[model samples]
Target: MIILGLIAGALTTGCWLPQLFKSWRTRSTKDFSWLYLAVFGTGILLWMIYGAIKGDLAITVTNSLTLTLTLAVVGLKFWLDVLKPRVRARAEPPAGGPSQRSVLPVDARAVADGTGDPARAEM
Candidate 1:
């Protein structure tokens, strides 16, 4: 039964990955409901507290890990969609620069691989 419970926990918790990845790739969270994550994560945190009080290892571990992963997604959503834009706005001006037209912003791999052209890389 513990094995089954752990498996279920892992399956459900793992669901966050694809959504997080989608948000990361798109650099947008317009489709994701922030309020839902906040509420649901609060419930998960409460469960972790309950598990601790009951000395239930399975519940505590599962909910603790889930809460961490959920918070990571929320942080990424804020960073990629919200803070990144403000930083980008500062980097570019009305006249524009060469960095503006040739490519979108990119990760270090693109620069390290000597393929600074993100559009050509199809990332």
Candidate 2:
């Protein structure tokens, strides 16, 4: 029973690794909604607490580790998606600043047509 519990716990907890790795590698968590992270993280915390109360080693350990991984992903999302953009915006001059130049050609049809799709524009 103990061995089975260990294996199950490991499999469930290890599932978080790939997503964590991708978020770190991309430095973007744009796909993760703020609401989902909040609710999911809260549920994990609740499960960990329930496991502790029941004196279940497998549940407690697995949830504790999973919570740590979830927090890391959430931290990356907040830093990369939320904080970094704000910092970059503050660092950059406002649009139409003297140093700013349009990347599109002056005769770009997308600009004239108001399509707003840079890819559709003729360079």
Candidate 3:
């Protein structure tokens, strides 16, 4: 029974390491879902609290470790989604401006037919 408990703890702990490492190294969680991670972290925290209340060592240890891992992933996702993108967007110039290259000629037929806005017609 003790050996089984140890094995289960080790396995559960091992499963979270990969996600922790990936989030740590990349520092980017674009592909990760913040909503899912948030919900998952909340669930893990609840599990930890329940395990503690029940006085189950195995449940407590596993849930504690899982909560830590889930928090790391969730925090990274929040940073990437809320903070990093805003910083990047602020750094970039506004759109709808002139480019460095020469402008292409507009089609007269399209302009004559008024398919597009007349303001877009070439002089």
Candidate 4:
């Protein structure tokens, strides 16, 4: 039973590697919705808690490791999809320099609409 649990835990916990690698390589998570990551992470966390309460070593260890892996992807998504863009948007343009393209997609749109300062919208 212990061996079986270990084998099963290893397989299940390792299954997230491909997706995590792809996300890290691409530095993009546009295909993933914020809702999906949140809900799935929440479920994994609950499973970890359940395993802890049940005193199941394999379950607890596997879910804890899986949660860590899941959070890496979540952090990448948050950083690349959310925080980085906001930071870029807030960035000021170079002084006395030609206007450059906006790095943030939203700011680029604002530029198209002529609502944002072209200089500040610079990448």
TM-scores for every candidate against the unseen true structure:
0.69, 0.75, 0.65, 0.71
lDDT of 4 by residue, 1-123 (tens): 777887898899899899899988988889989899899889989988998999988888888998999899889998999999999877856676545643344467777888888668645
lDDT of 4 at 95: 73
lDDT of model number 4: 0.85
Which tens-of-lDDT digit does each residue in 68-120 have in candidate 2?
Answer: 99899999998998899999999998777745466446556566688666655
Q: Candidate 2's error at 1, in angstroms?
A: 2.2
lDDT of model 4, residue 16: 88
Worst 10 residues of 2 by lDDT: 98-107
Instruction: For each candidate in the order shown, give its overall lDDT on alpha carbons.
Output: 0.81, 0.85, 0.77, 0.85
Ranking by TM-score: 2, 4, 1, 3
Model 1 scores worst on lDDT over the 10 consecutive residues at 96-105
Indicate whether candidate 2 or candidate 3 has the larger TM-score. 2
Please write out the lDDT profile of model 3 over residues 23-123, one tens digit for every residue. 77988777777677778778878877887898878878888888877787777777777988999988766687654433566666887787866567665
Candidate 2 has what TM-score? 0.75
C-alpha RMSD of each candidate structure in angstroms: 12.5, 9.4, 9.1, 11.2
Rate residue 98 of model 3 by lDDT.
50
Question: Highest TM-score among the candidates is held by which one?
Answer: 2
